[model samples]
Target chain A: MDARPTGFSRVTAPQFDPVVRLRDFTRSFGDNTIISGLDLDIAPGEFVILLGRSGSGKTTLLRTLAGLDPTPGQNVIVPASRAVVFQDARLLPWKKVWRNVALGLRQGDVRQRAEDALREVGLGHRLDAWPLTLSGGEAQRVALARALVREPSLLLLDEPFAALDALTRLRMHELVLSLWTRHRPAVMMVTHDVDEAIALADRVVLLDHGRIVLQERIEAPRGERGQVARALRSRLLGALGGQVLEGPSPAEIIALHAGGLA
Target chain B: MAISHRISASLGSARWLSPLLFLLAWEAGSRSGLIPERTLAAPSKVLSTLLDMAVSGELADNLWVSFLRIVIGLAIGVTVGAVLALVAGLSRQGEVAVDPLMQIKRTIPTLALTPLFIVWFGIGETPKIALIAFASIFPVYLNLYSGIRGVDLRLLEGARSFGLSCAEQILHVILPGALPSLLVGLRYSLSVAILVLVVAEQINASAGLGYLINNARDFMRTDIIVVCLMIYAVLGLAADALVRAIENRALVWRPSIVAQ
Candidate 1:
C-alpha cells in the first residue's frame, strides 16, 4: 500500500495514488476547444476545488472527471463509481425528497441511509415533501444528498450551490465540510466564487484557458473565511493573467509542501 | 361585488337550465301547431320513443354492441399505438421508418376508408373495429413521440452520472418524464375511438346507436333519431369522463392545474 499522509502528518503532502489522471486531455465542441493538452491529477480524499470564470472549462474538467461527458479514447482508467451533483438540483420531479436522495441506492434499507443523508444535510424534516415544493436551497441540498448517498470514490459538484442565497450557501459549505470530514472521498467542485474555492478546498486549483494556471495550498483552518477570501482573490486574479505564477507547474505547488512553503 | 357574484352563479346554472328551456319550448311549439308534428316532433314524443326502444331491449342491445366495439377497438388501438410510440420515441431508426406513415394515416379521414375496409374485411366487426383503431392510433403516436423528444436532457444526464444503464434510464426517467404527454394522447385517442365507432356502425350494423339513427332517418322517425343522437352525445361524454378519471389517478404526482 502507498504510504498515506494523515492527520497533522499530512503536512508532508500525502503520496496519493492519482485517482483521476488526465494526460494531454483535449476536448472540443465543433470548432471551440474547451480543453487542450490539459494534464490534471486528483488524489483520493483530497478536496480539490476548481476555480474559473464561466466557459473557462472548470465545469467541463469536473464533468470529465465524473465521466458524465464523452472523452477521447486515451483518457481511460477513469473511476468506475462516480456521483455528480449538477448546478440545478435536477431532482426527479415525480419522486419525493427521500426517494430522490436514495435514487441510486437501488434497494435494501435505503430508507435509513437516505434519512441519515438528509439529516446530515439538515433536510430530514423535508424527506416526504414534493421536490417542486422545495426552495432552491432545499432542492440543491437534496441534489447533494443524492450524490453523497452513492458513497462514490469520486464526488463531482458542478456549481451545486451557485443558485443559493448567501446564508444558505454558507450553511451548505459547512454541511459539505462536515460530510467530507466523515466520508473523505475525492471531491472536485467547480465554482466561480473564488472565496468558496478557498474556504472549502485543501488545495485550490485555478483553471484559465483550459489549463491549470496556479494551484495554492490553503493551509489555514476552514473557518477563516476572511483570510481565505483574501488568499483566493489574490491567487484567482493571478491565474486570470494566464502567466505562470512564480514560474512553476501544479507539481511544484504540491512539492512546495515539503519546502515549508505556504 | 356581492351582486356580481349572484349574477355569476345564475349564469353558471344557466348551462343546464338553458337546454331544458329549449326542450320545453320545442314541445310547446309542436303542441301549438307552430310547426307540423311529423316534421318536428315534441321532446315528449322523443322521450316516449326512447322509453319504448329501451323496453323492447332494442336500445340496450344497440348500446351493448356500441360499448363492446368501443372497448375492443380502444384496447387494440391504445396498446399498439403506445408500444409503437415508445419505440418511435426511443429509437431514431424506428421514428424514421414509422413517422411519415403515421403522418399520412392521420390525414386520411376514417369515414372515407369505410368502403375500402368493407371490401377488405367484409361488413363484419373486423372492419368496424379496424376503422376505430386506425382512427385512434395516430393521435396517441404523435403526442407520445413529441413528449419523449421533449424530455429534459439534464435529467438524463443526472441518471447517466449515477451509472444507470439504457433500459433503467428509460424505465426510471424517460417514461415518467413523457407520461403527461402520453396521457394527453390517451384522451385524444379515446375521443377518436368513439367518433370512428359511430361512423363505422352506420353501415350494415345489425344493432347499434348508429344503426338506429340510420333506420330512423330512412323511416323519417325524427323522434327516434333525436333519441339516438342523445345517446351518442351521452356516450361521448361518459368516455371522456372515464379517461379523465384514469389520467388523474395515474398522474397523482402532478399538481392540479387550475384553469383561469
Candidate 2:
C-alpha cells in the first residue's frame, strides 16, 4: 500500500491497493539499455494509458509488466491473474474461435464460459469460426474475448486497435469502455496516439527516453467534450513536441463515431 | 479467340479424351505392323494381360506383397522420423545431438547404400525392408524438423503470456502450427516409400511386382511389363490424390480453403 516518492509517477491515492508496482526497474540487452530506473503502479480497476514514441521504451515496459520479458527479482511486481491482447490479435489460426478464448482455462464448463465471453464481445455467432476467416476487427474482438475470459486482475493491451480502420477503431473504443466498466480489471494500454490515450485513460503517463516525463490525471469523466478535450490535446501535443491543432478534432471524432453507428 | 475457346471447351468436357485417343492410335499402329509388339505392347494387349493376371490371382498376390512392404517400411520410417524430429525440435541439447546427423543423412543418397544394405542384411526381405525404411526416413525427418523449427516465436510468446504450460504449448500451439509441413513430409515420405519398394522388390525377390516384372522380361511378355508399369504410375497418382484429400479436410482453416 506504500506509494513510494518516485520522480513523476508518484501515485497520490493511498486508499486503493495497486495490483502492479514497479520500483527502480532497469532492463538491458547486452550493450543496449532499453529501460532504466522506472517506477510505476496501477491500482485496481484503474485504466492507465502509456503514451510514448517508438523508441521511448513503452513496449519494453509493457512486455516487462506482461511477463513476456523476465523482470530481475523483486523490482517488478504483478498479479498472477493477468492477460495480454497483442497488436496482431495472435489467435491460433487452427483453433476455432471459442476454443481460442477458452485456452488454458481449467475450470467449470469451459465451452460455456467461452460462449459467454464471445457473447459479451458481440461475437456469439463466430463461436466456431476459424481465426483466419475473421475480419481484422472481428479477430481483435475475439482477442478481447480471449483476454476477458481469463478473469484477469490485470489486462494489458498493446495497441489492440492500431491496425483497425478509423470506424472500427471507434467501435473498439466503445466496446472496450463497456467491457472495462463491466469487468473492472486494472488496464494498461500502450499507444502513440494522443487522442486515443485521452479518450480511454483515467491517467495518462508519458515516457521520453526510458523514464516518465509527465503524468496527467484526467479528473473529468471519460470522453471529455469541447474545451477539456481541446486543452488536453494541447497539453499532450506539447509533451510530444508538436504544436497544437495538428491532429483530428473532437467534433471530427464524434462525426467518425456517428459514422460508425450508421 | 473463338477457336481457342472451342478447343478449351472440348478439353474441359472430356477429361479422358487424350488418353483414349492415344490408346486408339497405339492399337491401330500395332495392327498395321507399324509398331513391333515385342518392343511396346499395344494398349489393348496390355489391358488383356492385366485382366489375365487379375483373374489368375498373380496380380493380387504380387500387389499384396508390395503393399505390405510399403506399409511396414512407412510405419517404421514415419515413426522414427517423427520421434527424432520431436526430440531435436523440442530441446537445444537434443538439436545439437540429433540435427547434424540428420543433415548428414539428408545430403547422402539413400540409394547409394543399397549395396551396403545387401551385404549387411543379406538379400532377403530384411534387406529390401531395410532399404525401403532407410529411403523413407529423410523426407519425413527433414520436412517435419524444418516445420517444427519454423513455428512462429511470437505465437509461442502469446501462449506463454496466457500461462500455457510447456507440454500444453506443444500440444495446442507447436504441433498445430507445424501440421501443414508435417503433412507435406508425410506426402513426400509416402511417395518415397513406393519408389524404394519398387527398388527393394528388384533385389532377388521371390514374390512382388518386381518378381513379376523380371519373369515378364525373361519371357519377353511386353504386355505384362506395360501392365506393371501402368500399375506403378496409377499407384503414384493415387498416393498423391490421397494426400490432397487429407490436406483439403485438415487445412480447412487456411484462408484459401476457407473461401471454398
Candidate 3:
C-alpha cells in the first residue's frame, strides 16, 4: 500500500496529433471504481506500455480506447479507426489466415491487402491455413496482420504475447517494433512484464488501483541496453511494490548469446 | 493423411463382413426350413422382391412420391426453423417473442398432433406433408438456436473492435460460427422428416412406401415389407452420410483429420 512514484511526470503536450485524449475518465462497477478521474494523452506514433497487476485495470483502459467498452460519458476521444490485438490472438477458428486478416475491410482488393499485411508479418505463405492449425506465434502474427491491415491510426495491444513461449515472445517484440516503425500508429500495449515495458515502450506507465501511479518516459531509445533503461525498470518495478525478477537480467542474457555466437 | 487413407481402405473391406455373415446365416436357415418364410422373409427373397418391384416400376413410383414429400417437407421445415432461430437468436425482442413459442412447440412431439392435422387438413397429401413438416421443425430450431446463441462472445467483440457493422458481424462471424450446428440440425430434421413421413403415410395413404407396406401386410408378403424397411434404413443412412459429406466440405477449416 506504500508504493512510491519516482522520476514521474504527468505527461503534457507530449508530441504531435494526440490520437488519444482521456479527460477525467472514471469507470465504476457497482460500488467499486476500477479507474478514477484519469487523464492521459498519447502523441502520434508513440509506443506507450501500461504495466500493472492482474486487477490493475490496464486492460480496462485499453478496451475502452478500442471502443469495445463504453466510455464514461464523452470524456474519451479516440479515432474512429482503431484495432486491438487481444492476449489470446482472437482469430476466428472457422476462417483462413487471409480471411481473418480481411475480416472488416470495406475496400476492394481486400485479399491483396491482407496478403500484403501477412507478407509484412512473415505469414504470406500461410494465407489459406486455418487459425486452429497455426502455432501460437503464427496465430498472433495473423492477429497482428488483421489489426494492421485496417491501417488504424491507433493500435491497442492487450498482452498479445502472454501465451507464447519465451523465444516466441522475444521474436514478437522485435516483429511488433518493426511493424510499429513501419506503420507509425500510436500504440498502447498492456503487460505485467517490466522488462518488456522497457524493451519496447517509448514511455512506461504503471497503474495500481486503476490510476497512473508512475509515468516514466524512456529517454533511452527502443532496444536500448544502457543504464537509464535498467534504472527505469528497477524504479518501475519498485513502484509496483518491489517486484523482483527470479531470472537472469536482459544484459546477461544478451552477453551470453553474444559470447556463444562469437 | 496417407496412413489414414490406407487404414480406412482396409477397414472398408472389413465393413461388409458382418452384413455378409448375417445374410449367409439367413440363407442357410431358409434352406433348412428352420426360418418360416411367412414369419420373416430370407434376405435373398427380399432382394428378389425388391428387383421384381423395381422392374414393374411400382417401387420407383412409390419411392418418388415419398421422396417428394420428404424433400418438400424438409424445405419448409428448414426455412421456418432457420427464420425462427434467427429471429430469436439475434435480437432481445425477437427472442422474447419467438423463443418461448418454439420451446413449447419443441416439447410437443409432432406425431402427437397428427390427428389434429388430419381433422384440419383432411386425409390427403396436405395433411401428410404437414405432419412431416411439423416433425422437421423442432430439431432444426433447437440446434440452430443453441448454435446461434453459443457463438463466442469474444469473436463478436473482436469483430466489433475491428469495425464490422452489426449485419457484417452476423454474416462474417455469427452465421459461419453457427453453421456446424445448423448442419447438425438439418441432419436431425431429415431423420425426423423421414420418421414422420412413415407414420403419416401409415395412418391414411393411397400411394407411397407406407401404402405399399400396408398392402403387403394384408397379403402377408413379408418379402415386400422387408424390402420397404431396408429402403427406409438406406435412406436414413444416406441422409446422415450426405450431412457428413457437407460437413467435410464446409467445415474443412477445422483442424481434424476427417475435416481435412
Docking quality (DockQ) for each candidate: 0.65, 0.74, 0.77
Steric clashes per prediction? 0, 0, 0
**Which 10 successive residues of model 1 chain B have the least lDDT summed?**
B251-260
For A103-161, candidate 3 gives per-residue lDDT tens digits of: 98878899999999999999989999899999999999999999999889999999999
Pitting candidate 1 against candidate 3, the one with the higher DockQ is 3
Candidate order by decreasing lDDT: 2, 3, 1
Q: Which regions of candidate 3 are displaced past 4 Å?
A: A1-16, A243-248, A252-262, B1-21, B257-260
What ranking emerges by DockQ with the best candidate at the front? 3, 2, 1
How do the residues B225-254 of candidate 3 rate in per-residue lDDT, one tens digit apiece? 999998899889999999999999999888
Residue runs of model 2 more than 4 Å from their true location after superposition:
A1-15, A246-248, A251-262, B1-18, B257-260
The TM-score-based order of candidates, best leading, equals: 2, 3, 1
Cand. 1: chain B TM-score: 0.90
Tens-digit per-residue lDDT, B108-222, candidate 1: 8878999999999999899999998888888888888899999999999898888888988898789999998988998898888888887899878878888888888888889
Put down candidate 2 lDDT per residue, A18-93, tens digits, no spaces. 8899888888889888888888989999999999988999998999889998754546768889999999999999
The alpha-carbon lDDT assigned to residue A236 of candidate 2 equals 80
